[model samples]
Target chain A: MENTQPATAGRQDPTALPIGILAIAGMTVFAAVFLMAESEAAVGGLLAFAAVAVLGAGKLGLLERVRAAFRDHELTMHTAIVIGALAIAWVFREDHFALLMLTMAMLYLTACLGLNVQLGYTGILNFAGSSFLGVGCYTAAVLTQHTAIPPLVILPLGGLMATIVGSVLILPVLRTRGHYAAVVTIAFAVLFKTFLEVNDSLGGPQGLAVGEMTLFGWGFNSNIEIGDFYASFYMNYFLLALVITILAFALTRRIERSWVGLNMDAVRIDELAASCFGINLARWKITAFMLGNFMIGTAGALLGMILGFIAPTNFTFADSLILLSIVLLGGMGSVWGIALASAIIVMLPEKLQLIQEYRFLLFAALVILVLRFRPNGLLPRADRIYFPGWRPR
Target chain B: MSEAILDCKGVTRRFGGLVALDTLDLQMPRGAILGLIGPNGSGKTTFFNVLTGIYGFSDGAAAFDGRDITAYSSQEVYRAGIARTFQRSRMCLPLSVFDNIMVGNHKRLDHGLWANVFARKKLRKAFEESYEEAHELVKIFDPPLAERMFEPVAGFPMIDRRRIEICRALISHPKLLLLDEPSAGMTHEETRQLMDDILEVRDRIKDLSIIIIEHEMGVIERITDRCIVLNFGRKIAEGTYQDVANDREVQEAYLGAE
Candidate 1:
């Protein structure tokens, strides 16, 4: 209470809190009083334990200070959330399935954000974001499999490759307007997927097995123990997630406030109006598609590294819908909303394990309920939250 | 005066074998309101589109401010300072009102991709310029328009949406402004107000020339310095509103038909 930290975010997320603090502040405050009045030692002790547990939450505040100290400054809230989520996922490495799912969700969020650059922000509604993710996945997987190049080199190359492909897909279809352009972009994605599936050299059906990347002679396979816990591989995962998430946040925020962003928002509103303003639709659309998919590709590389596998079966049209749903459910062009939506969407199926065989039905029902109740997802941005009661930040 | 600002010399367009226009010629004087009137499908909208480069003429030449704009692309035409509103007032329903006008002023943006995305000094300057221009034009509509400019246009009603469309066109400060049925859906009072605003717009910019296609007779008669009447895609009459109103063909084609 006496000392103030440079970086502190007010939170009480039901995780990492001390028993004494929670007893004095959270649910236990009233519940603890009643238990003490009853003079039941077991209930009082339980309440005291909860209070002590909640007090440990102060560490979460301390973490913000430690993170701010270590970071190169410009570590925004968006990046903090992403890094925190990735770090937590890696911390639970014993559950490989959870790691796979969370990483995939992160990648999916990146893809949706990429498409938001096309459809949500600019009103292009590109069906090619998932294809770019697939392209990126295969690009890194194939490059790493056949050659001795580092993952970082392949990472950028994957982005460039997707950008080139994105441009090629956009150029001819530039004349198509409305849903026609969307259909054409989707057709290109299907074509790309088919091209990859038919190509024998790029691992046709068997899929590509990428060799591990070595950083300064220490391969990704090399693990160093930090006390009792294995930390080397986890550090690589966190570092990758941290860097890409930072770059994505920085790039996106810059775009949101840029002239091109202004132009994109214009194009989204009215194409004829945009043209009158002298905005070159073809030029900006291509640029946006390229920038968006470039992020998708980088995230795709991260996805591949985490999973250490890539196959055509994983990337499909259904995957695009999943990403698009995340964007729509999150409120189209909102960055934080989409990212948070991705996390919830990723965790949904596991949380729905009780429904088992009817999981898809349960998922669909849950989505309907969300759409019916809160059209915007759990946390919505100021602009998209249409209710007058909600205040803008 | 000064190449007549906009000169459509013998412009003709065809839809399959149907002759929409047969070498129609018109001269729009600089900094003046030119009204276009005709029965439905009488080539009035078609003529406006041809001039705006939204539609290509089959035969004839149109020049704007001494430039041979006959072959200019839509983008080129727009870059050349030509902006127009739609007849039905098609607005980006999802975008906020201010963004609607901001989109309209898109051509004025001077930033490239790098500058735009990075918000470098150049991008900020470009946005500032456009924002200021938009801010001024939006004031004519109302005070809330400038304040609520961030609201998306699609959710706006008939009047605000129409005004937003016009403000968007005006944001770029076009040399030649085209209004396709601007007073189409307004009440008598609204039309009167709009006509006064149009006249004010002309009075403000000495270099600004406008070609307005309108169905509202009151607006056409009150605001237009010169009026052109078409029937069956032929120039039935041209002159002052009195000159066209008294023309037998024009009267029979429009007022008589109604």
Candidate 2:
């Protein structure tokens, strides 16, 4: 199904909780953590958030409009960043907490976007997404850490590297098809893990540690002061993550509604019939796989930046399955579904800390129940999400 | 006389060692209804599959509108003005009845991602024109169906599903329409109305040609400009209704057969 923004009044239904409220709540919590924290960097983070929060809430009527404008996943899923930022403000408004949360949120958003491309639009049960993300992480990590190039150049290069590697893995396997396709992709992820553990040039099992990512003149290693907090290179790098995430989000959304998206849906609906429509089945299938993997690579880069470390164990098939579960629980064929699924998958374990290892089991069971009850997703997409152009009824 | 619109020469096809078609040659003149009749296991369906490129032929080449298309895919063949209905009713189940027909208009979509999003200038223009055309076709073909355009096609019963299938295929305004067992599960009156609709389609596109496959003699006699009979990949008879019906060989073939 395609998205057609319902009328304004319909969107602003009084019964439904406004999306902005969540954003505001997230900010308030971040502010408390930021202002009262002991770290000098924490104070600056708090001020940055306070400034952003004031702007966000100052125009209450506009904020309401913004809430109404929440179309898809950007609503609930992006809320994690707001919440995380607010939390950072609450505990330690110093250092790069606000920046870190934003960057982390951006990376998560990119991952969600990537997963949506595979699971939402294409109907592919890709369980190798995280492995590709690892590819990006490793690529960016090695280039920026080992070489002299700026991270700006390395990030896109990292995405390209992962895309090339992922395409080589995914394109040829498309002919194998169905549950078999997923199995092969998962096998590829495991293979990547094996390669990482054995290979020496990529730092072997311990993986590569990131080096400094100095921008043109901005020495990321330098520290700055804003209000009561101190800022460092980590904070700037985190902001960089937000930049990449926004770009990824826009691009993914565009492709989701484009001809590629529609044709991909056609593939999901019926391969034989779609083939009869002059659509090249092989090319589109490969392209979708590659594009999805490209975003995963970006996510991987962000993940690498956040931790400044990488290892073979990080890119396991389990991570891929977790991502798949997120997409499934959120919705198949929905951008928002991917976002919501990511937020839940990332946040739920923290909230249900007592469940410990059983959290995954609980999620798995919940996914099954959701599938049984709402076969489509939490927000089922429009089935005939057709472009009412060029073709007569 | 209308010019021959479809030509097949030395179109040979085989299933392993089994011959599905043996040097089969046929010509369908423009604006004519061609009937294909055969017993079970005959090559009628095989020929349809071959012409539509569902299965590659074992040998030979073909041309349509002065272009060789024997090597093209089914979709390519469709783009070159060929449309067909499935014997089992292959209408898109999830799409709306109208949307199924809109598929026929796929060749017409011009906008990429951005244009499709906002229905930008060129795409919006195309959308408006196409929607109008789909609406007009629905009104002319089945007035009642025109109103039910937004309903899911899967829910339609046997008759309406077939009708929607025909509507979808015809929406492309093909030069050649291939209907495989259009009346397979229909009542007599339903079959009659379907035939009438087929005639209306022919009239609407005067240059259009239809190669219809059927076992029913009544339908063959009523709609065909000429008929071809096959038995086990071999052509047994080719003639008009009276000519083929009166043939002694034809009488023998149909003896005690419905």
Candidate 3:
């Protein structure tokens, strides 16, 4: 038999770089227009256009071609995406509300990426994602109020605090499976809220005020004045959140593409098979749980600092469901899907006031529609490629 | 016997009041293919479970490669150079062929989180090596299948999936490979092909002992160097295939004596 290799093997598509850059530019323009739209009709029209464009791409089989191009030129595509995201801030430099919303979306994206590690990648169901975020927020709130430590220093410290608390929660979580495990997390979520509400030292139901994030004498809470050009203070928070989100996204992708991801997938699919193949089931589960909690905690800490105050109400069970919806709606285990889902989940309600009051219902309806039509998610996770420059034929 | 890779003394496994595997004494020499055959519910798989540490020994001990592995966990057993394929074909169907095989290569891969994330060049080098190893192993089974290395296993047929499962077990380069009903859900022709593939694997991978639990007498007769027959959770006969085929107890257990 002749030795046959895939035609595209080990070769970079010449069009990939240009296509990737164009895609990013297109997305950035759409985001800017969507953000600047004042009338509800304009916002709805843009949403419809996006929906139609995505559907048309799928129908024309262009989605796969775009995906292949992105995969072939990952570094280029990723850099373009980062630049495009940063350009959005530049476009809306004076729009405080847009910057604030953008920052919130990035923070939520970070938290959802963490949750994806456990729920999507590891098959560990965690319904109390907001509780871990609360752990981080509360940790930051307390540390900033009582200590002389810098808020930037307290950022990762809040993540550590959540990981420590998550370790305790995982004890019960580890003992259960499927819905039982979800129940354990749910109980923890309720318990955490009650603990915060009843504990006076932690400010009870009124919540606590968190100090501003400062790095080397630059307060993130202050507006920027660049010689006749004025930008909202939220831009500072947006930039920081963007950095954290990018790091989280990159780390999540690395984990998903490596050997650790293979082991986690093995564990997720079949514990018996994973164990027999030398994967420590408990170790992977704990690793995923702790890592996820740390990401959520850090994002929450930053969110607290961004908001300047965080009450128990901000991290309620309903809030957690919204995070879960983003993961489910985005397509489990797909980072790109999660990023898109978070953006839509965060921006949709705010953009259209008519659906803001019934946001939960809207989310439920959207999730139901997606699950019914596209169960694997809007953009399901693609196959893992071990070697660079190799695509499955 | 002294050079055996797997030696078990009084290996027993009991579930509630029923003894699934009675005090079974078994020895498999290095580089030998041992066939474990028995009627359904006669403890053939139960014995495998005990030996591989999937099920704890009720009242016995097992040693593999000169180490006491009686108390080892399944993961520890695998790390100690023992790998296995499941009876029901437990392939992570969503995973690519390379990914499935790499699951068994976990013992060889650097699993440190920081290393996987920060050490890109090192990780890439490791992945390239693994891909080559897995590709070569798959090529031994089917040259065509080797070309589709990154394709998901879900799209493969039963024989190819079985081949992939065997390749997964072989990727770790184990001292012993446990195949539980490899022929299940496969046609007779596919089984014959798989048996040839297994023989090819044993030849390519030096000194690799294999313990296969098969119901097909022809398969046991053709491939296995030695045969162990079980009846009522006890070893009824053990010897060459002809010896066990001629044993009165083995005959009685299979055909029901008048």
Interface DockQ per candidate: 0.33, 0.32, 0.72
lDDT by residue for model 1 (B1-258), tens: 475888888999988999898799999777877898999999888887776677788999988888899988777888788888888887777656656676666665555766655546665555556656676776766666665655556566687787888887887778888899987777878877776766676677668888889888888888888899888788989999999888888888976754
lDDT of 3 by residue, B1-258 (tens): 459999999988999999999989999899999999988999998887887788998998998989999999998999999999889989999998889999989899999999998898999989888888899899999999998888889999999999999999999999999999999999999999999989988888899999999999999999989999998899989999999999999988998998
User: Best DockQ goes to which candidate?
Assistant: 3
Per-residue C-alpha lDDT of model 3 across residues A12-96, encoded as one tens digit per residue: 5565567557767888999999999999999999999998987886676556556766777777788888899889999999999
Q: Model 2: how far is B153 from its true place, Å? A: 3.4
Q: Report, for all candidates in order, the number of backbone clashes.
A: 27, 24, 0
Q: How does chain B score by TM in each prediction?
A: 0.93, 0.92, 0.98
**Candidate with best TM-score:** 3
Candidate 2, residue A55: how far the Cα is off, in Å: 34
Interface RMSD of 3: 1.7
Q: Which ranges of candidate 2 are over 4 A from the true structure?
A: A1-106, A211-225, A228-249, A384-393, B96-99, B111-121, B144-152, B158-160, B215-218, B246-258
**lDDT on C-alpha atoms for all candidate structures:** 0.68, 0.71, 0.89
The lDDT leader among the candidates is 3
